[model samples]
Target chain A: MTLILEYPNTQLKECLIEELQLQCTSWRFAVEANNLSPWNRIPEECANYIKDYMTGKGYQFDLDRVSNEAEIYARSVELKGDGKDAWIFDVDETLLSNLPYYAEHGHGLEIFDCMKFDEWVENGIAPAIKSSLKLYEEVLSLGFKVILLTGRSERHRNITTYNLIKVGFHDWDKLILRNPEDLKKTATLYKSQKRDEMIEEGYRILGNSGDQWSDLLGSSISDRSFKLPNPMYYIP
Target chain B: MTLILEYPNTQLKECLIEELQLQCTSWRFAVEANNLSPWNRIPEECANYIKDYMTGKGYQFDLDRVSNEAEIYARSVELKGDGKDAWIFDVDETLLSNLPYYAEHGHGLEIFDCMKFDEWVENGIAPAIKSSLKLYEEVLSLGFKVILLTGRSERHRNITTYNLIKVGFHDWDKLILRNPEDLKKTATLYKSQKRDEMIEEGYRILGNSGDQWSDLLGSSISDRSFKLPNPMYYIP
Candidate 1:
């Protein structure tokens, strides 16, 4: 079955914008107002509008039927450590927003300009997704390990790692990247191979978080995998 | 991009059968003959005949390619135990011949013909692949691990395990079978999961010998996977 994401129409978008102004208490309102709340109290018009918006963009927010329990469990195992699962997170579109870059221009295939992307990373510019960043810090405070696995080649690893540190993802176990030659294969395979090697070295991967499937599928060792929302369109 | 297996024809098959008779000094004729002489040395008529026979029977005697180095390394790791990566072989069509049963009776899809299949698995019925069996024994003598993984359900595990012992695959560290509930997934995944679990439990999967992809693919933890020629076809 094809799963479809739904979003509100222009009218509902306007209403939500108004609601945002009314509930301007904190950044939490922005998140809560973004259709994450229970739909019981939500007006039909807003719900329909949100559904239409999501469907148009091909984003299926709800994945109830996708029973990836086995895959999830496998991912979680890779993250678990010291009796607590440690997570390695990818920043851009995983924990941070590339939206500023997208918004400054437009939303489409042409949105990603490599030079601009590099500049953003070099400048340590992207802002973290507050909700997920909060979750990341919570996991860290609770003594879970957090590492970063990225596709930004080694050339960009330093800047990317620094950006993560600037944004408060501290004490990372490792920051991994694709070996230049191995880029010929899918990034998922490369990451998975590295994760498997880590497993061989005696690390029980308890959990992994990423915005793309490649970040999760390659690890032969992870137990649980959590995918954060990515409104921006980078899938590599 | 399509990798096809090419086989020798019928006349060449008859000639090879005759050659087999003449070269039957040891069970090593298959490997030795294929390695020692070029196919071009055979008469044109004989070559064409063998090619036709092989192609007609869907046999690609010499076309299989091993292209992935990562896969090779993984296989090697699975097989190389500190003298523990002996040979964990599967039974039906792997070590013993099952053609007689299929030839005399009908195929496996008709119904539950337990008696017929059971008689085939019963002791002293089928002969081992002499050359491969010799290799297995040689590896065993070197003091490696030997563990069998099979698609046979747990209910039949006892009987299947016993049959292997009777047929001379002695001294196994473990005999694993498909749990009844896990039957829904492909045998390859089942075997792979079991093998991974074993690897996690500290047993290095050195080598796996199987007649089907399911058997070979299951143990991603293994170092090397060897496929034995299966004259008979019964893979589940």
Candidate 2:
């Protein structure tokens, strides 16, 4: 009878692990789908799971797949010779990955610290996400005027430009940063306003790529938007 | 040296599996995010993976999590007592599980068959996704008018109604279906047009839940939309 009870106990142990994993998978699905929009922090139970996702092949694979899909969409577009067709790309997770910084910050387990994150950004040592860089080059080759639209403050322009250039990003038609006046705006509104201004100026946004839903949503959203996975932190 | 070579060979075998699994994970992420929209059928290589996903704890976990999140969002909305506030629920995978039929099929490994699917739908024996049924009840209790918006045509109305009723769904304000004229329209356009009509009628769409991006997208997309996971199939 004791051995029988032990057998079930062993199964129970395995069940607990499976349950945690399933829960995190569900959490990630919600996060990626923007169902859990404006989420503040990773759940304590999901910490290790999210850490594994960020540090393991999962992160690289997700990035590769998004870039691959974006490339497919980019290739499908019939580019006009007019050169007014534009591709909007978000700066942070979409192009220059902040993994180096996040690696030190518990892979979203820790609450985000803006001052510390800003310091990391100022360092401008972020590396290019390999697949996204490839897609960037492909988009440029496809005759889409590249637009680097970021929520980074205007003060970060010089270092951001240097960082992007050092990481093989170049020849962007415009790198729009947030002005001090735009500080109060949500990233979604800020991006939409910029895109709106671009549309008013006759720049047709063919594709918009970003890790945040805010970057892809709102008025003047592109013809097609590709969302890259970012389980790290929500920016609402 | 031979032993070391054998060790590396074992590691290589593990790596191959890891690669395949990672690819499938990436594929699922893209699918959920709608980056791989209008995908026809599941990849042949992902057949076993997707089958496991659909049949195992993953599917149930996903359903429960989506319903849980939907419940949270539903509870958040302070619906007007006037009964003009509404919630949109997609039928097929949203409230009813086609797992009975899908179990016979290869869990999306096979190409979607309209005739066979129609026959299955006629049976009206589909089970309720328990979590979604609970969500359906919660939405009803929350003082919001429930709208059943589905891609299912008018032909399937009676059977669909029977299936939903058999599964414990009740008190829906409307069950909008596609007419023969609506057949040419994509699910997105058809659903959007319906939602637009409702909007014009002064109905406030507070929440929308669906397993397909088409259900939640387009012009009049709700105040908040929740996406349930359905890696089994993609509908444009």
Candidate 3:
């Protein structure tokens, strides 16, 4: 779906655009927002521009900003933290960069070639997004359990595990992927349900980080949500 | 969003799976049918398979099947037909085949590259889906006012009109594109609103055919709605 700012007032549209530009979910919500017009798709150039930033310092700044906020939240909750306090991280984009795969493909702008992407994942060569890696290391050091949750099918569990370890993400408290039972679940629902399980286990979720809003905006969510820059693709 | 059949009973799951295998929205509704699960992303292979069928005899059969139903309904309603009776046709996939464009891309399985698609559309090389063209001729001859409704942005009107004419769809009473004012509507909402306008203008919609369910499911709808098979992409 596309989102276009169609307000009569150029100033207001610009303002909303600025705000919505910050996150993919924000744009989605804005498109559905009563005040805004319906959107069909993101502009290709804009999507490509985001990809350019992804490998640049500006994109790194965005990640660093999100990771920094996560750090602050993690610290705030640290004093009261028990071993059960958890920080959730989404697998794709949040923790790992698929730039290599998307580089040949049109980032998230092109129709997703699942076979090609899965092959890339199976290669277990996706490196960690530097800032997220830093956050990952910090969260673990601060005594919060790291839970890696992804919408990936369970069939990729082995490769996903290998990729995570290969990229220096080690000893996560739990790694959750879509099992057969979750076939009918939306990423948001599946994620929320999984978080509820963690909550039921008495784990306090302190912070969450993901590229998509679905990963951060559901039931039993963490105290703070940190969204990194990702305009290439969106998870509904 | 993805849809998976995940009922506890293997038989029920299989049954649902079989049904959902037919369309994207089926899986969407099934997921939320009993408040079952939240889903994200369509299956890549299933989407591709649907694309395969679209160019094959299976797709033709589906079109012929829908056309036959339309013809039957039209014949039954022929006695009541008048100059004021209407039949609505959604443009893309309803009357035109985007196979050439999607073939180069990944059908709807890939992220929609609107720029490339629009360029393709501007080429106006999209061939008419033969069955739909036949249905169009049959309906017009039966004394119904034909209304062409599409979710394409209004700016594409010039190319759209040219394409429709070049593809041999002649003399539609009205050709409606999403105007600037319709920027906030869902496809269903936009089409329904247009139908309401037509109703206000004293038109009685007798029949409707579209690949997506949204084209036929909304308000002020026709007496009979015939759906053509399309599982490539979904419009929300």
Find the candidate with the highest TM-score and give its number: 2
lDDT of 2 by residue, B1-236 (tens): 99998998999999998788778878998999988847878888888888988888887888888888889888988877797899999998988889889878898888999999999999999998899889889888878899999889999999999889987999999999999999999998999999999999999999999999999989898988888988889988
- Candidate 3 lDDT (Cα, 0 to 1): 0.72
Q: By descending TM-score, how would the candidates be arranged? A: 2, 3, 1
Residue range A118-233, candidate 2, lDDT tens digits: 99999999999999999999999989999999999999999999999999999999999999999999998999999999999999999999999999988898988999999988
Query: Best by DockQ, which number?
Result: 2
TM-score of chain A of each: 0.62, 0.96, 0.80
Candidate 1 per-residue C-alpha lDDT over A120-227 given as tens digits, one digit per residue, 9 for 90 to 100? 767777776555566566566655666677777778777776777677667777778767887787767777787777677666666676665467654473555554
Task: Please count the clashing residue pairs in each candidate, in the order shown.
Answer: 66, 0, 17
TM-score of predicted structure 1: 0.37
* Highest lDDT model number: 2
**Model 1 ranges with Cα > 4 A deviation:** A1-85, A231-236, B1-236
lDDT of 2 at A121: 96
True contacts kept of each: 0.00, 0.72, 0.00
In the order shown, the candidates' DockQ scores are 0.01, 0.68, 0.01
Please provide, for model 1 over B87-165, each residue's C-alpha lDDT reduced to its tens digit, 9 standing for 90 to 100: 4667666666555565453322234365767656654456554444555565565566667777666777666766565
Off by over 4 Å in 3: A1-236, B1-41, B79-82
> Would you give the TM-score of chain B in model 2?
0.95
With a 3 Å backbone cut-off (N, CA, C), the pairs that clash in candidate 2 are none
Q: What's the true lDDT of residue B66 in model 2?
A: 80
Q: Model 3's CAPRI class? A: incorrect
Question: Where does the lowest 10-residue lDDT sum fall in candidate 2 chain A?
Answer: A33-42
